[model samples]
Target: MITIQNLDKAFAKQKVLSDVTIKIADGEKVLLLGHNGAGKTTLIRCLLGEYRPDHGTVTVAGHSLAHERVAALRKIAFVPQLPPPIRFTLNELFEYAAKIGHCDIDKIRKNSIYFGLNTDAHDHKAFYKLSGGMKQKTLISIAFSRDADIFIFDEPTANLDTMGRDRFRERISADAMKEKTIIFIGHRLEELSSVVTRIIELDLGKVIRDEQA
Candidate 1:
């Protein structure tokens, strides 16, 4: 479902990823574990086409990110480390997502409720004004509501509380993500053990370990 070949990236004179390569098959849920500056985010950016690789190629479902960025990205559902600073109201945000993603707003509302976010209560609230947990829930809800073939989440639990995390796990458990390629970047792997079938660890911008769980 995803492949990276001879990927290299740098900022100024400092390298962030060095000849990194990986291939993740469909339905595999991978935990991208690494400390800060370990190049995890850099690699993700390259895969997402947010940062063109200094060298190499990233392909998703046979679509080259560099050459077919838009089409390739259409197959992915992403929840970033930080929620975007959009001031769109909850309804507007959902509307926009539905328009662009061609996803079901009903699914978004259902998933949000399952994740403990009452969309009805927050429908008039602007995204930026929601509490951290609420924001995280909404983002996760939106991501999951999409029909993308791949799902990527970065530090998704950073703003979630204990209960919210539990709700999140319940929503993204392996069975729930069947046939979808899921890649999650976060330090709390143990908390997500049930959903992860593979582990890919990065260190100092290089892939140090790739193993099946």
Candidate 2:
């Protein structure tokens, strides 16, 4: 389980998040909703231990984000808003991530198919050469391959086409059935309705709504 209490963060003179408290039970699927600059990304960063909270605490699977960064990261896999810089082919990237994440190649290959990645294209082309949707698919494939207890994704559907968006949600739904905790940050609530079990809305760094969908 993840427990966040009184979380606060600020940048320069502006507060990005304040007194934010939330709890995510194991296996729960949550959608984080907010406009641009509403702190969704900031909150995900804090949860991933990429940014330290100015005050308060965040605990994931019993490990505190501030005290046990590596331990905390071990339990979570994060996909950022921007796709990762593809300095190599999709296969090479997957091999590197699997080695570091200790994931199985067979499983990663399966996820690659699940994400609609053309094995031939991904196998031969450099990541930078793939289309935007393909890059996002590769990013998601890497995240799922980690097999972490929790997954955090920010703006995952941004560059996807209609079919790609549907396929992405389908993959998410399938993953959720495996009982992994998923925290997704996105502007499109309608697209997430089918897979998201709960919704948390943020405005100017404060959580304004928390409700089951």
Candidate 3:
């Protein structure tokens, strides 16, 4: 489970998140909805321990994020909204991710293949050289390959093609994934409606609505 209590965040004295409190239970499929500057990304960053909250606490799977950042992060797998500008080639990236994440490179390769990404041909190519869709596919593959208690995807399908998007939706909606704690941040709610058990909407830096779908 993930817990956030009385969370508040600000940048250069500008408040971005205010008194945000939320609880995410295990095996819940949650859709985090919000427009730009609504604090959605900030909230995610806080949850991932990228940004320390000015006030309040964040606990993930019973571990305090403030006190145990690395341990807390080990329990989550995340696919960011945009791929990072990494200098490593596909092969190097996979090896590094496998080593650091303690995940199987084979499983990541399998997932990439399942997503129609030709990792073999792209192995020697730098990650930054890949097209947006390919980068997205690789990130998705890596995230899915990891063994984590929570999976968070931010605009995961934004760069995918129609078929690629459908494939992603199918994979995430599979029965095997039904029991996982998943959080999705996307504009296209219909694409994930079938798998989302609950919806939480944030606006003006606070949660305005949260209910079962």
Best by lDDT: 3
Writing each residue's lDDT as its tens digit, candidate 1 over 77-103 gives 999887888899999998898889889
* Per-candidate TM-score against the hidden true structure: 0.95, 0.91, 0.97
Report lDDT per candidate: 0.90, 0.85, 0.91
What's the candidate order when arranged by decreasing TM-score? Answer: 3, 1, 2
Q: Which scores higher on TM-score, 2 or 3?
A: 3
* Model 1 worst lDDT window (10 residues): 170-179
Model 2: what TM-score?
A: 0.91
What candidate 2 gets wrong by more than 4 Å, as runs, is 122-124, 175-178
Q: Write the per-residue lDDT of candidate 3 for residues 4-106, one digit (tens) a residue.
A: 9999999997899999999999999999998888898899999989999999999998889899988889979999987899989999998899988899999
Q: After superposition, how far is residue 64 of candidate 1 from its true place, in Å?
A: 0.4
The full ranking of all candidates by lDDT, starting with the best, is: 3, 1, 2
Q: Which of candidates 1 and 2 is the stronger one according to TM-score?
A: 1
Please identify model 1 stretches exceeding 4 Å from their true place.
none
By TM-score, the best candidate is 3
Residue 114 lDDT (model 2): 76
